[model samples]
Target: MSRKTALLLLPGLAFLLVGFLAPAVAMLLAPPGESAGTVVSRFTEMLTDPYELRIIGRTVLLALIVTVVCVALGLPIAYLLARSTSRWGGVLLAIAIFPLLLSNVVRTFGWLVVLGANGAIGRALTASGLTDDPPQLLYTPLAIVLGLTQLFLPLAVISCYSAVAQIDPGLDDAARGLGAGRARTFWTVVFPLALPGVVVAATLVFAGSVTAYTTPYLLGGSSQRMLATQLFSYASVSVDWSAAAATALIMTILVFLVSGLSSLAARKAATS
Candidate 1:
């Protein structure tokens, strides 16, 4: 509120404006030499085209699935990690988060190997007589979901872990002493307290999955094109700048929209 405080904030505000806001605004309004109306028309066409609609739907559906899976797995793991009494608790957490240190390409390639026709999964299935032939796994939506889930799970865990860690362990014990069972205590006491973190984790995972390029492109291939791959095609292959910019704008809006809803949900949960 003070002049000195305002001055201190000015540099960070200026940096954000220059680095993020300006580019985002420009990309939304104008794509290189294309006018606003051109990009708007492309965006409208993308919404109406059945093929493009499928791409958008697939992107959202997969993102939602990945987000749900990550939260379902991550929350429990994070809670356990936060409450671990073992001396190796830190080691366990390190193992859980280790995947984040690896490149996305490396992790995705690993999936390709495991999910390929002659890959580990297919081989195992065939050897067990589960199928007469290797079921096609790669270049499918399932493969994209699996790869994106693996890629973003650690982020979910880390986000939830910090939140779970902040809650006093005494609260859990007190709830138990008051005759609440483990599940009840978690739902009533721990979860409500941790909803914000869960929302944050979901938002991050959804955003990453939606905008992710390598895993979707490599695993899904041409058959399973999501918005990111579509954007790449417009930008590079077709050289359609307006369409590319429109796709980028849509992805950005999807992320921001989810984030806004998540924030509102978190606040409502807090108030409730």
Candidate 2:
């Protein structure tokens, strides 16, 4: 490459080296007095622990649930946003994306208030004779799912909306011209074309959900102990820096694996 091109890339390269790569290297190398082999052995032992395995399982399950729920809920809203020409489309898009602008702590706390025993939702349910007891909405798996879904819904909506908007309306029109119904055209043309976006959305949601700490920590109980929160507990509560580092490495690997698999599926779908 030319010197000018190399110069232009140098700033970004330096920033990544200092900001991202530096911290990752430090984390990997700075774990307590153990050698690399001992660190690997400790990690292996962690994997064999049933409690750790359960935490990993719950983390993966929660991430999958959040991804599925976000996609199912976001797809139609994205389609509407993509297809609408009304001035309100912009307004709706802004509303859909507004949550992403808020800090995750703020968003999770909002749900906490609403789902708490004396909160509006709980009161309304109790007043409406839905149940005799106020539901334990806070600090549950259900709460984690609800909070994470709300937190990640905007991502799915924006991804799907962008993909759907790129698709030519004429394609749908032509399918209709051939006597295909709305559902038929959408299933055959629109849905297939939008699969890339769906994959992107799912991948983003899964990654976010997997690494999410604040929401799960605030809204989840012992039963909902995800890997991120577990890492925090190790670092902060147990003061087990080595274990925390190992867990952090595992979480990073899992995120990359999930992203890589999603990318492969998207490419295959695009080609097929």
Candidate 3:
């Protein structure tokens, strides 16, 4: 490359080296007396362990649920944002994303208060004759899903909205002009174009949900043991650094796999 081109790339290269690559290398090389083979063996053993397998399954399941819920809740909001001409769209967007500005611990604690027995939801449920007792919503898998869906829905909505907004309104108008109904135009043209965004949002939600620690730890019980929480236990409680490293690697791989699969699906849909 030319000297000017090299100089232009230097800033990005320096940032990657100092901000990302350096820390990653340090993490990979930190532990002493640990061969690469030992790390691989520990990961294999974790796979073979039924409890570990259950944790992995639970983590994936929760992530899937969260992704689905985010998409379901976000699509309508995204559609509205994409269609809106009013300044209210910006206000809605701000409201949707407000939770992200808060610390994760604070957000989790907010949910804790809302879902606890004496909290608003519990009181409302009990008073409304839904149940004789305050529902045990806190420290349940449902609470975890509720909190995560709320937390991640903004990401999905923003992604989908960006994609939808990019689409030409004339396309939808032309479809309707050609006798295509609202539902037909949406499903045939709009949704197909938005598939890429949906895939992106799903991947984001899935990866975030899988690796999330604070929400699940705060809202879930023993039965909701996600892989991240288990990994934390291995590292902090058990002091099994090698195993923790292996688990971290596995989690990273899973995130990559999900992203790759989503990309492949999006490509196929785009082509078809």
Local accuracy of candidate 1 as per-residue lDDT tens digits, 2-70: 999999999999999999999988977797899999998988898899998999999999999999999
Instruction: Estimate the overall C-alpha local distance difference test score of candidate 2.
Output: 0.90
| lDDT tens readout by residue for model 3, 1-272 | 99999999999999999999876655543445566677778889989999888888888988999999999888778987888788787887788778778888888899989999999998998899999899899877899998888779888988898888999999989999999998899889888899898999999999999999988998996667887887788778988877877787779889989999999999997898
lDDT of 3: 0.86
Best by lDDT: 1
Task: State the lDDT of candidate 2 residue by residue for 93-211, as single tens digits.
Answer: 99999999999999989988999999988899889999878898898999999999999999999999999999999998999999999889988999999999999999999999999
Off by over 4 Å in 3: 1-3, 25-33
Give me the displacement of residue 226 in model 3, in angstroms. Answer: 1.0
Among all windows of ten consecutive residues in candidate 1, which has the lowest summed lDDT? 24-33
Q: How high is the CA lDDT of each candidate model? A: 0.95, 0.90, 0.86
Candidate number of the best TM-score: 1
Error of 1 at 71 (Å): 0.2
